[model samples]
Target chain A: MILEQTPDKSRKISWSYILLGISIVTIILFTLAPILWQVLTSVKTNEDISAIPNVYLPHKITLQHYLELFERRPFWLYIFNSALVSIVSTILCLLLGSPAAYALARMKLRGETIILVLIAVVTLFPYALLFLGVLEIIKNLGLGNNYLALIIPYTAINMPLTILVMRSFFRQLPQDLEDAAKIDGYKTISMLTAIILPMTLPALVTTGILTFIFAWNEYIFALTFITEETMKTVPVATAQLGGASLFDIPYGAIAAATILGTIPLVILVLIFQRRIVQGLTAGAVKG
Target chain B: MNNQRTGWILLFPALLLLFLIFLYPITRAFGLSLFTENLGTQLQPVFSGLANYQRMLGDGRFWQSMSNTAIFTIVSVALELVLGLSIALVLNQSFFGRGIVRTIAIIPWALPTSIMGLAWAWIFNDRFGVANDILQRLGLIETGINWLGEPGLAMVAIIIADVWKTTPFISIILLAGLQSISRDLYEAHKIDGAKPWQSFSQITLPLLMPQIMISLLFRFAQAFGIFDLVQVMTGGGPAGSTETVSIYIYSTVMRYLDFGYGAALVVATFMILITTVALVAWLFNRTKWA
Candidate 1:
């Protein structure tokens, strides 16, 4: 009777495991199906793409759509523009944000709470709400169509998260390390570069990745600020692909563009998934 | 004294930029809203105190977009919270390849919204969209549906896309919250002969409240100002049914070149956001006590 009962219980546990497996598969499919569809669509010929009843699988895979994207539009230019803006803005955000975060975390400064609260509020302000004013500033500064137009705003927008994340990391560091560096006659700048920064390298990388992803994916400002086709970022350029022609929709080329644009981000997510999750949770939960 | 000075010096640059980008714009928007500046005025500022505000009172488009925004935020956020919490709970349990699953889960959140919006638009395309194909295969519909061409359907499509992209973010935050929870509580509850559901309710929900509230508020502000998705998907669409406040404001200032009214709209939207956030925060606080 005992042996029979144990086998029955083990079978029940296996059944539950099966249920869990099924659920996991469903979640993965739901998360990936759209992206996978795009991948399939990207390689399909234009005829196959517009086929009646829809072509679930292409008869012949072709690179024609990708070639067409480059031929018909400044696709390479868009990639270059996006990369330049994202990298520069990310670096700027880190440079400016790290020091601020350090000061707030380490130094016993007056009005620290007020500054933090201000940052928290600013973090909540949608960039859409600030566009009109920012546009005005860009125009006044003659920064339109220039990379500065994108870089400056991206850095500023990402600053709040950068500071908040880095500040939390800084707070977690041992105070004795800083005190020891001070005793060794290290100045603030020297201590930061020599001791403090190296200790928070992981934090910097996490914040940098978050900032880079935001700068890369940003749309509204990219659309409004950079009207020059050569200067248009990936998101804006890819969006404009639809309306580039009146008659033909270029769905195949658009698919190719979408895949190309998302490849870098997908790679980032795959490689630094842990750090990205950490940065996001740290910024939101801790802040 | 020296340390305080160093702190101020270090903090000043970031604070200055934040002020210039955030605070100044908000204040300037308020001032600009009180003036009439548009093509009708040759893009020149004419003092028109409260005129834009008055116009907003009778503006049907503004109200429609506002209502649409409300629907999008409330519906998408509610769906995300439910879906996100479920995903978090599933992830919290020990499973094989959990790390890879979590990584794959967040890819949607990491991709550019505009790019994904375009992908979603194509997915819902009238002629060759996979959405129609899948639904037909499942025998859910007899014929092709023009998902983005119809008003109500367009909103549904946009909401679906938004939820897909953002649910992962909420899940990740909740997963962190779940990880921080001590396992001893669950074990003790189980020893008491408590059902799994009961333990989850008693041990998980209350502890995870803060993360839930944070994601809710964050997603609220984001969905309220949603621009990229709607703009790319339907361009506010078949009859402006999917036009969010951000899209409306963009077209107002950028397309119509109506800076004054645009600024007014900005200020009004900001107030609504602030009030709702405060109300939600207060409600959450009350619940915590209760």
Candidate 2:
């Protein structure tokens, strides 16, 4: 609206609209297709799934796969385990990461940069070897197949980014509130609890969701540590899904399970996408 | 000085956990890599220095996995970069339904990779899979191709799956970069009679280099250590052809229970990744934009 409608500007027929249309179509097809296909398959009968000519649409929709999924397998347990582990570990990550982040943000020290780099580098550490080491130590500590097995490592591994995001979030807060609280003889912890935390609810939620998603999605540790069937998380249990022989692909249950497993995260993403983006970019851009 | 002391005290818990969970385990892995310890036997102190390393060097499967890792990382990251940049460019535009589109874009990224890998495996299934059905519908192929059956096609399938899941991550990072660019530069370029492509190349790419490199480094390290997708889709099969270093090391440690050799493999993998990251970081630092 601000632009002067020069002859050239008026002559240009806004090809960007056309481009936008094409991009939207391509994005829908590429990005949404697989997920949509999974959803469709989730509702299809097994016969419909492997029909001679791919049954683009299900003739008869059924909740049988969903029923069978829960009946045949303890997927409820997997969901419960995933929820408990992710929730606890995400909390633990925030508790540990917040203090360090606050310290780094507030303190001006010679080795501050070095410490930040150290934290950042840990996130870059390859997990294959790291998981092997962690598993050994867990076994040595007599913690194999225990919930602590996954929780401790998940909390530890997610620390770097959590700290970085929290640090960036903390740095932006006004010093006046803390100074005012100090004048009233409010201690640091109480001040943080009453004022800073209550004020930074968005940041806390952002950090919490980011860590929650990471812990939920983690596979290798959960797979390796919890050899017991019931202890597996959704991701691992879904991967090693029973009833799918090499010959007969359990497309029905697999589809149902995939949809069921992913729907919660997708809902969270739909809600808090902006916050997640902030957390993701905060570390990369600042570093 | 007072603040520093207080800060350190505040930071103590995180530091302690890092030492316990991350640093200590890393150092212990390195130490364990030095000795030959078979997991079947008792925990004995028979130190066989460099033996595990020697075995790793001679192992064909190790080299195969190393190469497989290199191929997967390089190819997948390359495809993701191109697609991601395009997506970011489009998403950056002001248009109708952009909010919905942006949310849709992040969904693939939010979905767990391992589960998505499973989804992809099913989608690319030999007889009744959608990939084959779609291709055949388009007249691209005469018959259903067993996408995960052959080695090369399996690699392609996995890479495609990886790209689908991860491109959004690259796009989001680059979109953040794209949004931060000044409008004045584009307007100036427009006044100068520069083409859109010219503006993109001259104005945008240069400014977006830092984000580009960071995403590259981040994704490179991630793709290098890819496990779940490879594990789920192929199980590194059609004869261990798609097996990555992570899968190899994982199988050695978990399935084979070869602690010593797996440790050596771990150390080797660590060295490669660390060196590559350092090199990329050095390149990043050398670049004027960085």
Candidate 3:
């Protein structure tokens, strides 16, 4: 009976192992196929792109689509605008959010739970819903077509996530460290910059990357606020890539533009996968 | 008292910005909804109490968009939860090159939704699309399906794009929950002669409930307000069939220049979202108690 059971168990284990292997492959293919197809389409010539039988792979890869994309539109301007807005907003969000998070996490503040709950709710708000009012504000303040138009809102929009994630990280730290700093005659600002901030650098970087991504990818505000071609961000520019008529849709150039727009984010995700996951889950799970 | 002062000082800047951006807009939307300001009214602000809301009561387009938003949210969130859980389960296991697989899995979520939506549009194109080509090769269908041209299929296409893009987010959250569960529970369950399915149902599901609820609520809210994907892919087209509430409001405000009616739509959508979130939270808490 033992011998029979041993074989049966081994067979079952191998069967499940095989199943797991298949599932992993399927998951990878499902996630990566559309992206890989876009890459292929970008490199393919117009002839191959619109071929009757469909060209799975390019016959001869060409840089013409990429060239055409740059020549036809101000693609470089979009990239520059995206990077500037994302970086500035991320820096601003961190500057404002860190102290608030520290206060909520470490300081004996009144109504801390209410404040935190408010932050969480705000974090879940769909920003598109705020576009009409935000646009009005932008127009009235004459911030339209200016970098601050995107920067200010992006900074404010990202603050909740930044504060929530940082607060969670701060809560996990030992109270002894802050007490030690206090005994050393440190003020609140100095104590934060000198000790707590240095220790929670990873959390800062996590929140910073997440903020940068959000700012870079935001669409409605970018579209409504920046009408100038030179001020458009990657998402808005990419969405507006095709021709006026359906028949003249620039598939190849659009594909190239999509690839160009996504490369920066892809690199960021690959490098900071662990931190990104940590930041995203830190708020939701802990709360 | 000094420490409390310092704490409030530190908190003041962020709180002020949050209030200005979030609470102010919502309140202003409600205020703006009670006026008549659009192209037809010569873009001049006029006081008209409850007129826009009354119009919404008789508006078929608004109702259709609401139902569409509901379908998109329900179907996409449900799909993401199932797919995400499966991926999380697989990722939770130790395997060779697990890190690479995990990174690859989340690439979709990391990319901009608008750009990916465009890619999906091409993929679902009638003539040169990879989707049709593959189906034809596999003998699944003889003719190319006009994915974005048909009303029902347009919704399906957008949902597919949305599911692909967001499943990674849900999976990552679930994977975190899976990691927090103790291995001892599974081992103890096995010792009690529990099957793999039994252990998973009894141990994994119950333990992962909080994360599940959080992801569901987050995904539901995001999916309901979906704009970029639908805007880029179909532009809520093939005859307004795929238009979400966000898309409807966007057109009302931007295209039609109807600020008053748009504000009304915004306020109504916000109320619906808040109520649903509260209801879901209450239901989850009840389940937890039971």
Better of 1 and 3 by DockQ: 1
- Where does candidate 2 stray beyond 4 Å? A1-14, B39-45
Native-to-model Cα distance after best TM-score fit, residue A160 in candidate 2, in Å: 0.9
Interface C-alpha RMSD, model 1 = 0.7
- Model 3: per-residue lDDT, tens digit, A108-205? 79899899888888766787789888888888898989999899899999998899899889999999998999999999999999988789888899
Please give the TM-score that candidate 3 achieves against the real structure. 0.98
All candidates in order of lDDT, best leading: 1, 3, 2
Question: Over the stretch B1-290, how does candidate 2's per-residue lDDT look in tens digits?
Answer: 76678788888888877777778766887888887767654544358898888888799999999999999999999999999999999999888889989999999998889999989988899988888988998999999998998999999999999999999999999999999999999999999999989999999999999899889988998999999899889999988889999999889977877777787887888889989999889877887754
Residue range B189-272, candidate 1, lDDT tens digits: 999999988988998998998999999999999999999999999999888899889999999998999999999999999999
Q: DockQ numbers for every candidate?
A: 0.87, 0.71, 0.84
Error of 3 at B223 (Å): 0.4
Per-prediction TM-score to the true structure, in the order listed: 0.98, 0.95, 0.98
* Interface RMSD for all numbered candidates: 0.7, 1.3, 0.9
Report the lDDT of model 2 for residue B233: 92
* Candidate 3 DockQ vs. native: 0.84
lDDT score, candidate 3, position A157: 91
